[model samples]
Target: MKIKVVFLLVVELLVVIVVVVVVVVVVVVITVAIAVAVVGVVAVVIAVCVLRVNFVIVKVELVIVVVVVVVVVVVVVVVVVLVLVLVVVVLVLVVLVREVTAEVGYSTGSSVLELVFVIVVVVVVLVVVVFTISFVVRLLVVAAVVVVVVVVVVVVVVVVVVVVVVKVVVAMMVVVVLAIVVVTIVVIVKVFVVIVVVLLVVIEGEQVVVVVIVAVVAMAVVVLLLVVVVVVVVVVVVVVVVVVVVVVVVAVVVTAVLVAVVIVGLVVPPAEQNF
Candidate 1:
C-alpha cells in the first residue's frame, strides 16, 4: 500500500509538472507572437504614414496578414501537439501506476486512474474552450480592422479620381462638393466604428471592453481632426491624418486585445474531482 501511494503521488507530481511546463511554453510562444505582430503593424504604419510608398504599403499589409495567419496556425498546432503529448504521458503514468498497484496486491487502481483521466480531460476541454474563444475574438477584431481599412482605401481612391476628373472637366465648385463628401465620409466612418464596437461587445462580452474604449478614443481623435479639416477645408490633410490615426489606433487596440486574450486564456482554474 505504501509503495502504491508513493507511486501515485509521483504520478500526480509529474502530471502537475507537465501542465506547468506546457503553460509556460504556451505563454512564451504567445509573447513572441505578439512581438512579431506588433513589429509588423509598426512596419505597416511606417509604410503608410512616414515612407508613403504605395508598393511598400501593399507589401507590408500582405506580410502582416500572412504573418498573422501563420502565427495563429502555428500556435494552435503547438497547443494541440502539446496536449496530445500530455495525454500520452498521462496514459503511460496510469499504466505504470496500475501495474505497480496490481503487483502489490492492490488491484483496485481504477479509481485513481479515473481521477487522473478526468483531470486530463478537463484540462483539455478548458484549453480548447479558451483558445477557441480567443481565436474568435481575434477574428472579429481583424475583420473590423480590415473593413475599416478597405472602406477608407476605396473611398479615398474614388474621391481622388473624382477630384482629378473634376479638376480637368469642371469648376472650383466641384472641388468644394468633393470636400463636403470627404467630411461626410468621415462622419460615416465614425458611426461605423461605433456600430462595430457595440457588435463586438455584444458578441464577446468582457474581453472586448478594451476594443470599445479604443474605438471611442479613435472616434474622439477623428472628431477633433474633423473640426480642423472643416475649418481649413483641406482634403489632403484630413485624409492623411485620418488614415494615420485610424491605422495606429487599430494596431494598438488589436495588440492590446491579443495580450488580454493570452492572459485570460492561460488562467485555468485548478480542477478538483472526488472519485
Candidate 2:
C-alpha cells in the first residue's frame, strides 16, 4: 500500500510538473513571438527613418545648390550689364572728345587736346580694370560656394549611410542572438523531459537508491540549465544594449520556469508507510 501510495504521489507530481512546463512553454513562446514582432516593427521604423533623413538631406542640398546657382547667375548678369554700359559710355565719351579735339585744335593748342584725350583714356582703363577685377572676384566666390556645397553633400551622405549600416548590423545581431537563446531553451526543455522519463522508470521499480541518485543528477542538470540561461543573458547584454530589455525579460521568465520545474518535478511523497 505504501509503495502504491508513493507511486500515486509520484504520478501526481509528474502530472503537475508536466502541466506547469506546458504552461510556461506556452508563455515563453508567446513572449518570444511578441519580441520578434517588436523587433520587426523597430527595424521597419528605423529603415523608414533613415530613408526620410536621406530624402530630406538630399532635398535640402538640392535647394541650396539651386539657390547658389541662381545667385551666381544673377551676379554675373549684373556684372556683365554694368561692364557693357561702362564700355558704351566710354565709347561715347571718346567720340565726343575726338570731335572737341578737332574743333579745339583749330582754336586751342593741339597739346591741350592731346592731354585731355590721354586723361580720358586713363579714366576708362581704370574703370575697365576695376570692373574686370569685380567680375573675377564674383566668379571666385561662386566657385567657392559650389565647392562648399559639394563637400557638405558628401559628408551628409557618408554620415547617413554609416548610421543606416550600423543599425542594420545591430538588428541582425539581435536576431541571431535570439535564435541562439531559443535553441538553448529547447535544449533545457528536452533535458528536463528526458530526466523526468528516467525518474518515472526508476521510481516505478521501487528502487530508493536509484531514485536518490537520479534526483541528484536531475538537480545538477537543472543547475546547469539555469547557468546556461544566465550565460545567455550575459551574452545578450554584452552583445547589444538595445536587445537586453527584451532578452532579459525572457531570461527571467525561463529561469523561473526552470526553478519551478526542478523543485516540483523532483518532489516525491514520503515513502515512510510500510508496503
Candidate 3:
C-alpha cells in the first residue's frame, strides 16, 4: 500500500510540472508573437511614408513634363494657324490676279470655289487640333489618377479635369474672323491628393495568424498595383497613337493642297501666256 501511495505522489508531481511547462511555453509564444506584430506595424508605417515621398517626387516630374508638352503643343498650333493664314492670303492674291486679268479679257477665274473650300478645311483642321490637345490633356489626368490608385490603397477616388485653356476653339474662331493671333494653351491638371490610412488590425486572433494575414494582404496589393499600372500604360499609349495619327493626317492633307496651289499658280500662267 505504501509503495502504491508513493507511486501516486510521483505521478501527481509530474502532472503539475507538465502543466507548468505548457503554461510557460504558451506565454513565451504569445510574447514573441506580439513583438512580431509591433515590428510589422512599424515597418508598414515606414513603407507608407516612403511611398508618399516618392509619389510627390513623381508628381513634380510629371508637372514639368506637362509644361514641356503644353509649350510644344502651343508652338505647333501657332505654326499651323500661321500656315493656314498664308494659304488664305495666297488664295486671295490669286483670286485678285484672276479678276484683274479677266477684265483685260483673260480666261475663266482659277479657283473661287477652291478658295472657299480651303478656308473650310483650315477651319476644320483648327477645330480638330484644338480638341485633340484637350483630349491629350484629359488623358494625362486619367493616367495620374491611375498612378495614384496603384501607388497607394485608395478607399475612395474622385477624379476631376479642369480646363485651363479650353477655348483654343474660341481662339480658332477669332482666327477665322480676324487672324491667327491667339496661341496660348495653359493646362494645369490639378489632382486632389487623398491618402487613406487603414490600420490593419486582427482583433481576437492569434498574433502569428495575424502576421500571415498582413503578409497576404500586402502581396495582393502589390500584385494589383502592377496589373493596374500596366493596363494604364497600354491604354495611354494606344490613345496617344490614335490622336497623333489624326494630327499627321491633317498635316499631310494641308501640305498636299499647298503644293497643288503652288503648282497651279506657277504652271498655268507660264503655259497659257495669254493673260
Candidate with more favorable, higher TM-score: 1 or 2 = 1
What digit string (tens of lDDT, one per residue) describes model 3 on residues 17-49?
A: 332233223222322332232233223322333
What local lDDT score does residue 54 receive in model 3, on the 0 to 100 scale?
Answer: 41
TM-score of 1: 0.40
Predictions ranked by TM-score, top down? 1, 2, 3
Candidate 3: list runs displaced more than 4 Å.
1-62, 65-76, 109-130, 136-275
Query: Which pairs clash inside model 1?
Result: none
The TM-score of predicted model 3 comes to 0.27
**Backbone collision count in every prediction?**
0, 0, 0
TM-score of every model?
0.40, 0.28, 0.27
RMSD of every prediction = 28.7, 45.3, 39.2
- In model 1, the runs with Cα more than 4 Å from the true position are 1-60, 107-110, 140-144, 147-275
Number of the predicted model whose TM-score against the real structure is largest: 1
- CA lDDT of each prediction against the hidden true structure: 0.45, 0.41, 0.37
lDDT of 1 by residue, 1-275 (tens): 44544454445435434543443344334333433433453334333332222345465455545554565566556656655665666566567656655666543334543464545445444645464446535533553354345323422322332332222222222333343444344344534444454546556655677666766776677567556644554454344334434544555555445434433433433253221
lDDT of candidate 3 at residue 211, scale 0 to 100: 58
Mark the 10 consecutive residues where model 1 has the least summed lDDT. 164-173
